[model samples]
Target: MRFIKLFCLLISCSFISPQISAQGNKNISATEKKILDQGLVDIQSVNPEILVELKYATPDNFMKKNVYGDLTHAYLQPEIAKRLSKASSLLKKAKPGYKLLVYDAARPNTAQYKLWDALDDLKIPARQKTQYVADPKIGSNHNFGCAIDLTVVDEKGNPLDMGTKYDFFGPLAYPRSEQEMLRQGKLTTKQIANRNILRMAMVHAGFTVNTTEWWHFDGMSKKQARAKYGMIK
Candidate 1:
């Protein structure tokens, strides 16, 4: 009778194991599962008001390739996610119907390598390439789940005119050159105001904007991030 009871228990366990596994992964892809495993929180889960449009997940980015397969959601460190949520709130309070639109976040080092390879194929010099995509060898703040690339969007979901497209790799995209670009008629006052709105929200929420990329912001310095968390492999 004991042997029969043990046999029944084993049969039940076999039936339950696959069900549990499938349930856990029902809506999550391998890449998302990995990011969650590394302790990154999904931004939408933190603040649904903040829109996510992962450019690398599609071919709309500068690379012009879909490097982030099955990774549509943006992920960030828990603290960083909270900061992003705060930024979203601030933007809503200031602009009423405006929302923060995320372009990219918490990139895997593997994706970084793919971006590097794409630039390499284009014959872009290594030094110049670093300005756009960080070298995978050293890793980026995104790899540490401490960075975000985002913009402001109106209630209609149309992105504000920030002078250039999200991934425009040129002087027009450089925040440092915004004044010069404006003086030279390359950027309009309204464009600079739009960019400033984004900066105000993010900077007030404890993020620092990148010098070259108006859309890029760091939740913490790279050195600080490296000390706090391991890079997302």
Candidate 2:
């Protein structure tokens, strides 16, 4: 009877191990993985001072689901990673006690379809949704590993209040609308200043800020980005 129980346990373990391994590799396609291997680098390796929190890898994002499955690493194109490292160094030099906290980077093109489908269920107009998330056909700089969503944090890793959350899809999240938001009391002066500090560092390090999202920054112009990098599908 004991031998029979042991045999059953071993069978269960054998089946479970394969399932777990498959789950680990299922989120990213083979082609995507190969691109990542050849063209991207973990941002942490470029700047150990930067803090990485891959929101899409967990259920804490706007999707409210684990879109990145088991992959939690924040990766970027090699040049982008170097620029991010420079940005981190600039911020630290300027503040001496702050660091950049990254939220998302190097999103797969396949994942863009999931976000697009989820947005379709909402009452938002297609144009409005596109402002926040690019249509998969057009593709985002993130899909090319040339964009990043991030904020500033203090020495202790406490995030600076940027008036809105990372994925906030409203006018309040707009860097261009900060004055209007401030006038409406939706955002404070200090929050705008904090946002500017982050922008200054990234801009000086060769990144362009998006008009709609204060947290979103592109390593290059959209035209240059798409032309230079292949979309990660």
Candidate 3:
């Protein structure tokens, strides 16, 4: 979300402690860097690849607090940049005027703390997990600058309907909705169509969709996707 104003509350996701959160940019490794570099070289811009906007935060929902690098100016590592470079070509190949909005990129999962804050503004509930646990804090792929939260925008720069708002995390983002009425709460029929347009385009371009979050996609394959990946956090 450019600014989905979810409320602010600190809850430790797992062994992921505040001290651990302080260890910023932990997902980046040397090999990942190599992939990013070469990936960029192969990345091709769609017909009219362009950067319409680059929003960092909206006062209440900030992402740079304890993460790595500057939050105000988002980053896409190298691989992601490569993938997006291909997105333009992919979109233009599929349909003219199809564009992507890069909402969040290269943000620490701790940045998720701010993302949750925006959930309230969008009426999405935050997972009520307890303060601490024994989980390994695998860390967000964003630490490696691999993950991003965004949606398809029209040539005019308006967000298309995808049955629900980006990052909503509710039942709608599930990517398998059979409920037509459920769509009325947020997106309309035309919006959903536009959403599918983008989703389909992404799938054809070697990206994998997150079952629970339509706006969340990664270029990593099934094996590489679960390679116990970590960044420089």
Task: Tell me the whole-model lDDT of each prediction, alpha carbons only.
Answer: 0.90, 0.85, 0.51
lDDT of 1 by residue, 5-26 (tens): 9999998877753422533434
Model number with the top lDDT: 1
TM-score of model 2 vs. true structure:
0.84
TM-score of each: 0.88, 0.84, 0.59
Ranked by TM-score, the better of candidates 1 and 3 is 1
Residue 165 C-alpha lDDT in model 1: 94
- lDDT, ranked from best to worst: 1, 2, 3
lDDT value, residue 131 of candidate 3: 15
**How many clashes show up in model 2?**
0
* lDDT value, residue 36 of candidate 3: 40
> For model 2, how does the per-residue alpha-carbon lDDT over 1-233 read when each residue is reduced to its tens digit?
99999999998777753322533534555544555565777787677778999898888888799997655778889999999999999998999999999999998888888888788776678778889788999998989999999999987889999988888888999988999999999999999999989999999999998999999999987689888888877
> Of 2 and 3, which scores higher on TM-score?
2
TM-score of 3: 0.59
Worst 10 residues of 3 by lDDT: 127-136
Model 3, 1-233: lDDT tens per residue? Answer: 42333222223244453322432434444433443442321111221253423344542123333332343434554555666767667877777886777665655455445444544555433343211100125445554566656677777877776766544535566655524434455545665676677677677766777666667777674235336444433
